[model samples]
Target chain A: MNSMVEMQNVIHRYSKNTIIDKVNLSIQSGEIFGLLGPSGAGKTTLVKLIAGILKPTEGTISLKGTALRHLAQMKNYGFMAQSDALYQELTAWENLDFFASIYNLSRKRRKERIRDVLEMVDLSSFKDQPVETFSGGMKRRLSLAAALVHEPELIILDEPTVGIDPVLRRSIWEELYELKEKGVTIIVTTHVMDEAEKCDRLALIKSGKVIALDTPQKLKEKVNVTSMEEVFLHYGGETK
Target chain B: MNTFHVMKRILIQFKRDKRSVALMVVAPLLVLSLMWMVLDHDDSKLELGAVDVPETMLEQLSSDTLDIETLSSSKAEGKLEEGTLDAVLYFENKEMSLLLEGSNPNAAGAIQKELQSLREDQQNMVDVEYYHGSEDLGLFDYVGPVLIGFFVFFFVFIVGGVSFLRERTQGTLERLLATPIRRSEIVFGYLAGFGLFTIVQSLIIALFSIYILEVFMDGNFLYVLIVTILLALAALSLGTLVSAFAKNEFQMIQFIPIIIVPQVFFSGLFPTEGLGTWVQIIGDIMPLTHGAEAMRGIMLRDASFADIQWEIYILLGFTALFTTLNIFALKKHRRL
Candidate 1:
């Protein structure tokens, strides 16, 4: 399978502190890839780099064989940051419509995609409600729906399920799997162990460095662990 | 086409935020109307004290417009110091000497005006020379155009700057950068979106000031709209640029004193002519100064488009420069 994203020697810094240090990783197409790390481990920064919302201080990030500097190539992916980022005063449907329109989808396509994503997030009934009235979990789902609205080949979600309930979280995971079956490449960042276990492959990041990279089963086996939590502890503690 | 999407989204958002809509449209109008009422207040009666004046002159001065009081010189000085008497007229020599309270320029101007007219009617006095503005000019006629440009620029600057800053703080701007949209497109999208309401705002305020409030409107209405709109554009661009430096809404408000107040001080609302050359240079750098100057030129002086063309270009130049800086500022978030 072709690599959907390629980060070579990516080094990102804020002021004098290095956030992403000389790291390299390749994300294959049509797989659920999880970046698991503790808080402040630069997971958000690295994901933002891949989503083309930020630039690397010392290397290159390419999406679909094209450098991110070419803005046209960025349309191939959808990005969701930790924040819901919805227009508070606008209705949920209007927010989705705005994003869909930015992608230049046909009016019919825009309506259909908006309906599909809202249903996928179980927010179809609340489409006309203003986003300010939405609960935290509802807003998170809406943010997911917006990221999925354009139906791009790649999706980058940063802590997408942080505030969601377990049942709704399971539903969202099922939807993400369904998209993966449709050949969409998903890159999700999370500190949740069970969620990390769901990814086809995991990159265990610690202090801005990816300490281990493999399938969850293989990683656990290599660490002589039964759960991803043990594998994370093994690496996080061993590094010290 | 992409710009239209951004514009549409902004308009939709505006529809939902009724308070912001009212603030942008109604606040300026309310303040301006209040200013008109104050500036266009009916001429006030003057209190005059006659100290050692002939009874004939005292009788001439005693009318509905002037209330003359007979008092000793010391008593007259005390009354003037107490702000009771507007002025005290005394005759020590053949030459006339008038002691004015001198506080409140408007009251002083009123006293001077009444005395000038009194002198004229009594003796067919020394011929008064004509100047740039006729003697019939009211304070509203002089300050209306400045306030018009000022309110538009002020409100648009605050609203545009704060909204753009919110986009940053709320993470929407980062989300926007992730899309295929160019930085310039985002900036232009905001311009087109905000630009629509700005035009409407300018039209309503200009028309009301001219037709309803009866401010001086000697030139083309179209030119007035054009100047006001350009001033708004300058404010919009400068405001967005300033927002990049501000981290939050409070920091944005802090800019009012630093950026907005200086412009008002020299926007020709007061007499900038008496200011030193270097101080006047500060006015030249302020967009409001040029905007107000152009507005006054068109409204009061009947200046044609060609006459105020330089100011229009300066305003446009300020917009272009600030917009370019804003686009460059976006590079910090996303290099492309």
Candidate 2:
């Protein structure tokens, strides 16, 4: 399998403390990958480095066989930031239209694709609604829709469903799986135990280091655990 | 820059935030219009009262200059107190008594200046006077053109700078950066976008000041338009350039007293003759000094294109320098 992203001995530090050290990770194409960790476990920092938003102090990252020296190279990969970055005064269609224009999406294509994405996020009925009027859950789904509007090959979602209802979260994951079937690489950072099981593979991270990397079944078998919570505990080095 | 994208975005924002755009453009127009009404009130031939004046001296006074209404001393005093008569003249006992108009400073200054010049001309008989402009030009008329330029530069700079800073602090800037667009394109896009509305802004202000306010349009109106548009360019560039350094709108507003008010002090709005040497030097580097000088020269003094050409060049140079510095400043946004 071709590795979509290759990280070799990446080291990142903030201030004097080391946040990540000599970490090696390879994310391949056509898979839903999850980074599972507790808060402050450096999972967000690791994904941000792979997305090329942050450069490693030591080591290199190659994407699709090209070194990520140019930040625009990473632009082809959609990134959903932690905040819902929609303009409050702008309508949903206006926000999406601006994104489409900024990505240089063609007029005809933007129109059709905006409709498709709005429908995909269940915001089609509220196209003219200003983003300020949107609920927190709705805003998260809208941000997700913006990241997927261009239909890029790779997507990096930083805490995509924090306050979302379980039913809607399940639907979003189902949509991610559908995109995976169509050959898109997805990377998600989450602390939720059940969501960790949905990924094709996961890297259990703690303190900026990946403590475990394997399929969910293999992780459970390796630790002789029946639940992801127990797997997290096993990787976290708790005797229980 | 993709001008259409930038322009469309601004137009939408204007439509949504009509209050801000209107405040920026309309507020200046309202203040200027009030200034015009207060300053441009006409002074017809003054109905002065003269008593016991020599026939020769009284005949020598031009008919166009005064009406020469002969009234009693008591009547002249009453009219002066009521502000009906502009002045009263008496040459009894070889002592001339003059009563004056006291309401507007410009009217008093004009009358004093004209009488002084007329008195000097009378002292030199059969002498040719090589006068350039009328000695009786109103003070408002003298300062009006510079005020026009000042208003445009002042309003555009504050509005654009604060709005751009708001974009940065509100996380919209980071959102924009996440897209597949270059940093320089974003800067240029803002310039072109804001530049479009400010063109209409500049035109309305210049024309209204010249035609409606009658604020002394002496030279070619087209040249006035050219200088204004160029000055707008300078202001716009300065606005975007400074926005890079400001973290919030309040910080942007703080730049006004530092960056803008000093321009007024040295921009010919105030007399700078007695200013400290370095203060005057500071004015020389400011974009407003050039813009205000060019505007005053063109609209009030009726100076030709050649006279203001150097000012135009300096304004353009200021804008270009600010834009280049702006590109350099964007390095803070991204290393590249």
Candidate 3:
């Protein structure tokens, strides 16, 4: 598989301590790459660096062999934050509408994309409701819908399913798989073993460093573990 | 383009937060209305009870503010104790003793001011008339223009500061920074967003104070609205710029006394004419001072817009300067 994104020798610090420590990684095109780590393990910080929200303390991140600083690559990426980042005061449709404008989609395309994303999230019935009234699961799903509203080829989601129910989570995963089949590369950060199991490739990270990288089955087999949880435990060193 | 999105979110957020919405529109109007009623004097008579007043003192105490009745010494004491009379006076020749009910400060102040003004009138101090107008100026008349400036400064300072602070704390600010949207657009967007409301607010406050409350508008109505609105914009910009330094709403409110009160002191309600030269100079630096001066000039002095053009320019200058700082302030979120 060809690389769609790469982080080369990235180092980011928070005053006294480093959050992402000289890490180097590359993600293949059209695959769901999972960053598995506990909370405070720099998952959101790392994703923020990739999204160009922060300039890495040292080194660079590029998308499709082109630096994200270039207009084309920046436009081709969709980023979903760990927080919902939804304007609770606005209706679900309004939230999507406002974000869609930033992407510069034509009116016709924006409307259709909004309809598609709302339907995909199973929130079309409540599209006119204010997001402040949405349940935590609905808000998370709405955030995901906003990320996909622009239909970019590369999507980055930071802890996208934190408060989602299993049934809805499964549906969201199905949608992710469908997007992957259509050659959309995805990066998701999660500490949940079941969610990590869904990614085509997994990177086990600890204390701002990636400890292992392989396919879910391959990594588990390589670590002589039956479950993704045990494989992460093995790599994260929860055993003697 | 994305600035519109941020602005729309701001307006919607304000609408959703009913407490602030009420504060923005309702609170100022409520206080102003209270001030109007409190300041307006109807020249109504108060029942005065006198106990054994010498005939000479009774004649001197006869004024429109009082309807005096001589009571037996015991009856006068009873009336005073029962609150049947506002005051009970006892006089024996030139030695008079006055007893006043003092539970409410306003009632007490009214009695004292009336007595003082009557005494001055009797003593003949050029009748002490105001050069521009009569002494009939009411509570709203004295405080109306200053209150207008204060409301605009106060609410804009609060709403603008807190909302911008929220943007930072909520992480949406980081998301917006990640976009290609420029910093000036963010500042401009806030100006437009809050500007929309200030226009309506200024119009309402100006109309109510001048036309409804009859707070004395000697100058053009349009000039009054213009100065008030411009002040609101400057306050909004200054507030948004200050928000960059504040981490939360509490810190945002800390700016009120430091930022808003000093402006009021210099804005002319208090006598700053005799203040130390540099002390009075501090008032010149605040946008509210120029605004209040213009408002007072227009409403009280009947001055034209040209007479206050420099004031307008000074206010506009503050708006622009603070707006520049607001844009630059966004650098705290993103280096660019």
Model 1 over residues A165-215: C-alpha lDDT tens digits? 999889889989999999999999999999999999999998888989999
- Candidates in order, TM-scores: namely 0.94, 0.81, 0.88
Query: Can you rank all candidates by lDDT, best first?
Result: 1, 3, 2
- What's the distance in Å from true for residue A10, model 1? 1.8
lDDT of candidate 3 at residue B179, scale 0 to 100? 55
Query: Which pairs clash inside model 1?
Result: none
Query: Candidates' lDDT values, in order?
Result: 0.91, 0.80, 0.82
Q: Can you tell me the DockQ of model 2?
A: 0.35
Question: Among all windows of ten consecutive residues in candidate 1 chain A, which has the lowest summed lDDT?
Answer: A231-240
Q: Over the stretch A1-240, how does candidate 3's per-residue lDDT look in tens digits?
A: 889989999999888899999888999999999999988888988888888777788888888887667434556778888887877778999889877877889989999999999999899999999997999999888888888888888899998888788898898899899899889999999999989989999888888998889899999889788899888778776633
Candidate 3 on B1-67: residue-level lDDT in tens? 7677667766776677888877887788888888878777585677677888777767876788778
**Candidate 2, B1-336: lDDT as tens digits:** 344675677668777877878876788789888876776665666667777777776776655756787778888888888888777778888887676766767556656665666667655767455233354466667778788788888888887777677777766665666666677777777778777777788888877877777676668888877877777778878987888877777778888898988888888978887889988888899998998899888876778889999999999899889888887886665444
Task: Report the TM-score measured on chain A for model 3.
Answer: 0.96
Candidate rank order under TM-score? 1, 3, 2
Chain B TM-score (each prediction, in order) = 0.90, 0.76, 0.82
Docking class of 2: acceptable
Clashing pairs in 2: none
> What is the descending DockQ order?
1, 3, 2
